[model samples]
Target chain A: MKVKAYITLKEGVLDPQGKAVEHALLSLGFQGVSGVRVGKYITFDIQVRSEAQARDQVEKMCQKLLANTTIESYQFEIIQS
Target chain B: MKFGVVIFPGSNCDRDCVHVAQTVSGNKVESLWHKETSLPRLDCLIIPGGFSYGDYLRPGAIAHFSPIMPEVKAFAERGGLVLGICNGFQILVETGLLPGALMRNVSLKFICDRVTLEIENNKLPFTCRYPAHSLVSMPIAHMEGNYFADSETLKRIEDNNQVVFRYHGDNPNGSLHSIAGVCNEKGNVLGMMPHPERVAETLLGGQDGRLLFESII
Candidate 1:
């Protein structure tokens, strides 16, 4: 099965990269942008059999490696396709 | 006192750290490779700054999984003194040895210059030689030195007196609350963006950074 994880800095944590991107976009003639927050999207292929197992494994991965729980959070979804 | 400095594949400041520790502490400093599973018995362990693994993904990302990290974690858990400087600080964050993460500079540029730092907490084993609120000038060279943490964590750190250093004048990286350095709850581990080793001698421009190493001794 394939799983996708969305990792982002927790709300209220300053996102400097996101802000810089927003500034660059505005400078390039893009307007009406209020804000921007950047994040990481990771896709992994695992051998898990069930969605429950996938979720558990992915959460463990996030806690141990994928995310810095002190400032960021991660969520993963198992894809059937 | 004996000191050990971890050397990752792309670490450029290991020699600098070794030289400073040797000079200031008057001790023999050992360079431990990242693949080693054991750390030498020592009075202190230092993770020096540099582009570890060329900072392939994010700063300190690839180096976090280095084989020696587990031993480093164990050393910290045993209340051993650990100091991470600049890229070392980022590695500490990546290893979960310290709170918060270092994001890109708010200005989106690599910052390299001498800046003043306020010694916020002098109780740690690393900063015992400095007085509270003492201003010391040190050089910081990094592209991702902006520190970020959640509000609750920030409050907890403040309450626990974990904040050890803050920017004295203009905040260079837009770090939250101008935090330049922080210690762990046990006060044995410290991570900071400033390069104290770089300014440890008068010939290097100033000797203010010597106090940090002196404190450890």
Candidate 2:
């Protein structure tokens, strides 16, 4: 199995990098963009037999390594590979 | 007093920390490799700044699982004095030795310059040489120095006075409460973004940074 973890700054957390991206887009004449937030996308291969097992393992990975619970939140999708 | 400065694979400031801790502060110092499973009895441990493990995944993420961290965590749990500067601060938070996490700077640029820091609490073992609210200049060099925590942790720290140092003038990295440094609830472990090791000698510049090492000694 494979999993994709999307890690992002939690709501109400300051996203300076995201803000800078938003400003850069505005200066470049990008229109109708209300906000811009930046996050990380990571995928990993897991040797799990079932989707439930992959999800469980990925959740632990996200909590322990992929995401920092103090400042960021994450979600993952277990794709049957 | 004796000190040990942990040296991660990519650590660049370990030598500077040695100079400050040994030559400047006149304390015995040793370099502890990151893979070491044991530590010598020492009064203080300094985790200096650098891109440990090339900051893969996130700053300090990989280093948290290094061989030495188990001992470091045990030392911290026993109230051993630990000071994490710049990249070291990132590692400390990542290892759960401290709360909060360092995020990318608000400007999305690597910052390397001297910034004024206000000593929020001089009562800490690490800051007692400086008077409360005293402003001192130190160099901060890092891209991910902005600090963030959940509302509950922020509130708890605010009430507990865990903040040890804060930016004096304009908020440099967009850290909450202009925080440049903080300590754990027990106040034994300190993590700060600024590099006091770089400014600890008069030949380099003013000796304001020496006060921190001096106080610890």
Instruction: For all candidates, state DockQ relative to the true structure.
Output: 0.59, 0.85
What's the residue-level lDDT of A27 in candidate 2? 88
The positional error of residue B24 in candidate 1, measured at the CA in angstroms, is: 1.9
The 10 consecutive residues of candidate 2 chain B with the worst lDDT sum are: B19-28
Report the CAPRI category for model 1: medium
TM-score per model over all chains: 0.91, 0.96
The local lDDT score (0 to 100) that residue B103 gets in candidate 1 is 85
Instruction: List TM-scores of chain B, every candidate.
Output: 0.98, 0.98
Show model 2 residue runs off by greater than 4 Å: A26-30
Error of 1 at B149 (Å): 2.0
Candidate 1 per-residue lDDT, tens place, A1-81, comes to 899999887877777778888888999989988568788999989987788898899998888777777667788889886
